[model samples]
Target: MQDDQNRLNPSPRQESILVCVSYGPNSERLIRRGWELANAFQASLTILTVDAQDDNQYSEARETNMSLWESLSKKIQAEFLVAKNRSRNVAKTIAEAAKEKQVTQIVIGQSARSRWEEIAGDSIINGILREIEHVDIHVVAVQREIPLQQEDYEPGVQAYLVKDGEQDILQFDPPAKDAVQGLFFQSIYTDFNNGVFKVTEPGKVTKYQIFDGTVTRKLSETFSP
Candidate 1:
């Protein structure tokens, strides 16, 4: 009778949740959702990001996003992991990480591709399902308030911002002492270097409006969160 009672009341299985994110505005939403699930289940939480390039080769935007994610993970008392995928197989990397972490649940953002694209076997979720077994996956749909807009500026170029007295000057030449390295996007409508300058410093990402090679205002002021 005792053996049968013990068998009927099995111990609850421990749960670990892994959240996969990329460099985008939607990453924070996904992380928060993961946090909610982790709290509800009283499980360990982890934030994982897969990079296709080396750490030194990451773009300014990617670096900034990583920094932000790391800070957020720390705040939530979760482990932040960055995995390099030299072969660019992101799903395989994620699955490997999940196995290594003994994760029981995964939370990922829904792909922006249309249903047709997903049906054609281009979805990463499909690959992950094939790679892992006995793990629950949650695909969160990201809602966009506005449709993606066409580019109003030229492609971003590696540039530097040098402090010139009280103002900052944007230059294409090599960085000088006390210079901030970032990506500069020039407005295609004008001939001068007028657009936006983006830079990541420590735990913060800042953007400045540049007009005629000079910073006009802090663009981050207009950003929401």
Candidate 2:
């Protein structure tokens, strides 16, 4: 709810996916699952609504027709897109949107699928897949998204030595301990992948060691100081 800067550009968008809803009986379930899936992959959702309408103006009215469903999507804090067009081109429009948004996946209503459809006469689902080059699609029947587990975890710090696949030379001066100086599971970078890190106490370097090619005694006798 904070400003854009506070939101962190939407979490790096692990995957860009779009969902299409035909507003059928199962539309609600697909949207709910899409939301859950987006959160799981850290992806974004685009809800597309396709109908027999001829233009985009009346699409708003159609959406208003489904205000209750929209409210449901909001309840789960999921992103959605609503599109309205002639049924003949609805699938195409959805595919176009998928490409434009760089959609990683597509979720659509059950009405678009057929169990034993053939290739010569591909189903709407197959047509969408065949045309959309880069996007993947996920069709959901029910609330397929599972809720994330909330737990309390204790975080600790650790360190690692990094190089361009080679040892470096530097006096074993401890890294900056004023901020997170310790052994952490995360990795830091150095010149050309040459770097070092250590775990410290009070978030300070409790114990540290380093050997870099750039300094005298560049290679220390692997000692834990």
Candidate 3:
């Protein structure tokens, strides 16, 4: 009788979360906020990005940005997905992914890039709300960065990292040859060695976020319960 009753009761429902990110400087903030929400709900999180064009249309910078976001997603222990819009709209693509993942909550940034505006109308948020039913959406406010009057970062250059004390420090002009080669991006309006570093592994690429002069390899490492 006890065994039968336990089987009939079943386990509690698990929370499912989705975060939609438009590629931009503000995407990092959006991902962090989503992580916080997922932590609060004790939910499984998924990060999704949709491109209007096919994979062949992506430029080097676009590819780098996608890899960086994916790295960020893994750091937060969320599944990362990238989808292309062939026939449907961006909102529709997002809604489909949400439904597939059984997402109960969604997080998106209010300050999406202008490219998104060109592809979808200003009513993108409204469209998403209409498509997704019974799901809560959080619109996060992003502080926009002023575009540089002059070129801030040199064209993305080859750089690598070296172990220093407790953190991996990026060396732009390495004295030693055979250094691990990776693409380096510099941020505008900042004099410090700041931006994203990308390295390609066997079947995937890993992004190391650089701030001031330091970065944490911890984020790239797998998460544990």
Q: Using Cα atoms with residue i matched to residue i, what is each candidate's TM-score against the true structure?
A: 0.60, 0.47, 0.63
lDDT of each: 0.79, 0.50, 0.72
Report the CA-based lDDT of candidate 3 relative to the real structure. Answer: 0.72
Looking at model 3, which ten-residue stretch has the lowest summed lDDT? 216-225
Worst 10 residues of 1 by lDDT: 111-120
Poorly placed runs, candidate 3 (over 4 Å):
1-13, 113-117, 148-208, 211-225
lDDT of 3 by residue, 17-36 (tens): 88888756667667777777
Q: On TM-score, who's better, 2 or 3?
A: 3
**Residue 77 Cα positional deviation in candidate 2, in Å, after optimal superposition:** 3.1
Residues 169-196, candidate 1: write the lDDT tens digits. 8989996487999999886544556678
As a whole number from 0 to 100, the lDDT of residue 44 in candidate 3 is: 91
- Where in model 1 is the C-alpha error above 4 Å? 1-7, 112-121, 144-225
Candidate with the larger lDDT of 1 and 2: 1
Q: If the candidates were sorted by their TM-score against the true structure, best first, what order would they fall in?
A: 3, 1, 2
Judged by whole-model lDDT over C-alpha atoms, candidate 1 comes out at 0.79
